[model samples]
Target: MKYSIRNILNSRSKANGNFFMEITKILGHKPKNTSIYKKAFTHRSMNIKDSEGNAINYERLEFLGDAMLSAVIASHLYLEVPSGDEGYLTKMRSKVVSREHLNELGKELNLLSLVESKIPSGQFGENIHGNLFEALVGAIFLDRGYKHCEKFIYKRVIIPYVDIETLEGKVISYKSLLIEWCQKEKKTFDYNVYEDTGNDDVRHFSVKLSIDEKVVSKARATSKKKAEEKASKRAFFAFQNRISQFK
Candidate 1:
């Protein structure tokens, strides 16, 4: 029996083609240039460099993606809510594009599965998903142009996820709300954050939420901002009825 080299090469090429097809199915479009996608998934820890010795990682793409997301989301909100003032539209866009929301979207689509990183996924914080989502958006923009990028956002985000009524009521930052309420009520408020210096590997912060010189709530977290935010959230719920009237 004669084994032909050409036949073996053709079989391998066919397998590669099938792999790309699977990736296209996952991405919802056939990739025009695979290199863009490759760069999107590359992690900074890998220390990859381009032809000019410039760092080649997702960070730059993430920046571009963030701007692109804001633009698309802003346009959508502007057109959909005709009665919405600038402030209202901006808030609505923020609600949709918040880091928490983006992270949830990325996780739902398993975007992290495509990331190329030296660090273990378990070690990464929740923001990794959001960052990767932004990078992917940037990649799509570069590979396919603005119109295709807009189409992708419309299909993946607006069509399935956006509900104007639901978004309007969503709270992106309880801390901001608490502060606003305090200001409106002519009451003084402060977040006193202190180092926890606990036995845990991660540093911790303790926060006391003071309303009118009295401590309303106390909480601790891995970061001072998070601790303060948690305390403020608790303080808000404690005064929910009063806050609702102010809103």
Candidate 2:
């Protein structure tokens, strides 16, 4: 692959003094090991490799960050809602760390502005925001250990967003809600999804959500799962009153 001046400049920009300042602002303190943060924002598309020939990218860090987030959020839910049993606590934690929520957090911070990727930013999907957020958390854990990581999570995530009552009503998957309601009501539900090779390079899928042999809602998305979910959400809203009756 060829490298343009823009790509070269972008790589150099990651290490400049101003970049650290921007990071310090988000982290609420100066970072000791800036390279980890650099890794956090670096996308796998760059194909960077370490001296040991190990791939150097944010994916591993994202995994670590996800675990840390789960642990911290679980602890918070455990203490805050003493009466909640295992199932309730698990669901609450899932709501807090849901992809949509993390993506929103990353976007609110403008974290993607710091990312280094071979592909244009326009090509990246919404999940990139959450991926970067998780990688940043992992970098924090590596740079300053759990205490600093916890502090950053609380400041950025928990204190600002986590609310017990609000979270209780939050729906992580409208598809799950619709399925539960259907099962309870003894109604059959199905998502008929088909590949939609549109003009665009990205493959798409179209879905028709059927309830009791009647098509209730239809949607199209980049993936079958998403298409099904979009259709399910629409169907849920279409029958909102009926679905809510199960509550």
Which candidate number would show the highest TM-score if scored against the true structure? 2
Clashes of each: 0, 0
Tens digits of per-residue lDDT for model 2 on 1-247? 4323234336567455677898999987788977788788888898877655677789999999999999888888888899999999999999899999899789878999988789999899999999999999999999899877887887777765676765898678879989999999999988899999688699999999999999998888899989888788667756643212112
The runs of at least 3 residues in candidate 1 whose Cα sits more than 4 Å from the true structure, single-residue gaps closed, are: 1-22, 170-247
Q: Write the per-residue lDDT of candidate 1 for residues 62-179, one digit (tens) a residue.
A: 9999899999989888888999999999998998889998897787667777676799877999999899888889989998888888777776666655667558766777799888
Using all chains and alpha carbons, the TM-scores for the candidates as numbered come to 0.61, 0.65
- CA lDDT, every prediction? 0.78, 0.83
131: Cα error in model 2, Å: 0.5
Ten contiguous residues with the weakest lDDT in model 1 = 238-247
